[model samples]
Target: MCRPTAPRRGYDYRALIMKLSYQLVEQSWPLAKEFRISRGAKTQANVLLLALSDGEHVAWGESVPYARYGETLTSVSQQIERIMPLLSSQTSGEQLNQMMPAGAARNLVDCALWDLRAKKANASVATLLGLTPASTVITAQTLSIDTKERMAAEARTIGNAQLIKIKLDEHDIIEKMEQIHLAAPQSQFIIDANEAWSFETLIQVLPALAKLNVALIEQPLPSNNDTDLATLSSPIPICADESCHVSADLAKLKGKYQAINIKLDKAGGLTEAVKLMQAATEQGFIIMTGCMVGTSLAMAPAYLLSGASSFVDLDGPLLIAKDRDNGFTFADGQMQPHSSAFWGGENNQTNVELARLFTS
Candidate 1:
């Protein structure tokens, strides 16, 4: 059996007494309303939370096991369980990166480690990482793929949002854009096809989509078929959501994608996401930080990326029915970073509620 070793003479007792541990839980939250994209629709946001403890303080991180990426809640939880014994304060981010493949499971553990390290250093995660706490972040409000009327109604609801991300499919063509544009003429739009368009659709609709005063078009072509985007010209910028993952993807996307959507979930966590942003920015690609449908715990780390990005799409918590108490605030589409008590900072009872999420 394994055993704990005692500290040597004059050794700091705190170092020897402290233990690092983690717990993984499956959680689901109902959507405030329907949210759909090119892939499908979801009524609830299924998520996995990784809670890390340092025998003194606890911190949390959350990840959505995106079905679009072939991940489900059960698969994500089992992946976390496999690496439980290896989690420790001594395990560096580099070590974690080497231990797990980049996906939902790595994202969960990597973020939890960041939170725990902030606690160990007695600083907020943002502070520990040398980032300013944002007073407010402008986040995109999404209008899911739907009938013209429903899409229009949803667009109208977020008429005051500075940026509205409109999910599109190949079928609607001009109908949905016409309605949503007419409904919220004042708001800038991100026309996100989410890989629903074909080469012909891209050719046929680029002109009309350009005329809609769209600020950006995201992943209009399927990830596997978008290699030729560089050959086409566009008035509005085209962003890469599915095509770009880690920093290594930049070479393939250099001339093809004008912008890259950096989501913590997709990049595996903030550690790699930060490297992705720096790499994308260096290559002159516009940066947009996005999110999967998760709670504030997932979006919080991504919020730190907002300062370095031109467009911020961290609105997952906004679409969910009930977020954690004291989660990040989104009012009038303007985001405020979560309080220290929300994630890595001091809080007495938040962990109790977080624990209950696993039980109830």
Candidate 2:
């Protein structure tokens, strides 16, 4: 039989322990409620709420499902079911990482632990994680993919935004960029293809987008097909969204992408998200913090990384028809911190009311 090793120096093996569990919730919003490279078709987003239980404090986390990641409500529930047994037994973040594959389920559970830890210690997530708080970070407000005229109209409405993230499909690359530039000439533009374009189409599109002063183009090619990018070049920097997850992906993305968009769900949670951010920075990749469509709970952990990112795209809550009571406040194209009723704030809920809402 194998024996456990002695505890490491300066480590508390038994202190600050917690247990976590998850539930799936499906929410429906109107067409304009979701912003993406593809227009919303009566948006319905699935969220997995992660609840962490310390002896005295409880924390919650939410994960938004993305179809591109092979995740649906049923699939995420199954993933969580398989790992439920380990949530209460795992003693450390490293141990939790080994128990589940990196994805939305793990992300929610991982973030909940971070929240639980923060509450137990009465510290903010940033302070607990050794990161500084940002007063106001420039965020990219997304314009959903639509007809050039419609997209232009949407862009005009968000004219106060400093950076505009335009969603594009393989078609109408020039027309969309032209329309957006004409409408919001003063705003910096960023294009996200969401792994929808091919190398040939990307080549055909970059020159027009570059001329329009697009600051960045994200995930133009599908993740599996990204190797083809090394052979091509463009004026606007390319950022890897689907291509990057944990720190393990950094070596593979070296010359292919100038930046990487880090989402809490993709990194499996805020704990690993921070690790991946530091690793990406050391490897010389510009950082962007992004999110899938969900409420304030989903965006909370990502706020911890805003200080290190060049582009902040945690606008998911803003796209929802209605959000949690303490959801982020977005106005004049700027995102403000959540109020005390949400995570990282005073007077936060002491019980798992959100979790019970989904479970019941």
RMSD (Cα, Å) for all candidates, in order, is 7.3, 8.5
Clashing pairs in 1: none
Cα distance off (Å), candidate 2, residue 252: 0.9
Each prediction's whole-model lDDT (CA): 0.79, 0.75
lDDT of 1 at 298: 88
Per-residue lDDT of model 1, residues 1-360, tens digit only: 111133224422122212755555666688888898888898988787766666666677989888778898778777777677666776777788788887888888888888777767777667766665457988999888889999999888888888998988888868888889888888888988989998778788778877776899999998889978989787888899989888888999877889999988788887788788888888899999899988888888888887788899988888888787777888879998776766766333345655543334
- Count of clashing residue pairs in every prediction: 0, 1
lDDT of 1: 0.79
Across 1-360, the per-residue lDDT of candidate 2 in tens digits comes to: 112233335432223323433333344433335455542343645566655555455567788767778887567766766666556623456777888888888887777777766676677777777886477667788887889999999999987888988888888889878988999988998898888898989888777777886999999988898998888776888999999999999999998999999998898888788999999999899899999877777887798788888889988776776677756788866888876446754344554455454335
* Top candidate, metric lDDT: 1
Candidate 1 matches the true fold with a TM-score of: 0.90
Question: TM-scores across all candidates?
Answer: 0.90, 0.87
- Candidate 2's C-alpha runs over 4 A off are 1-42, 345-360
Relative to the true structure, candidate 2 reaches a TM of 0.87
Residue-level error in angstroms, candidate 1, position 29: 0.4
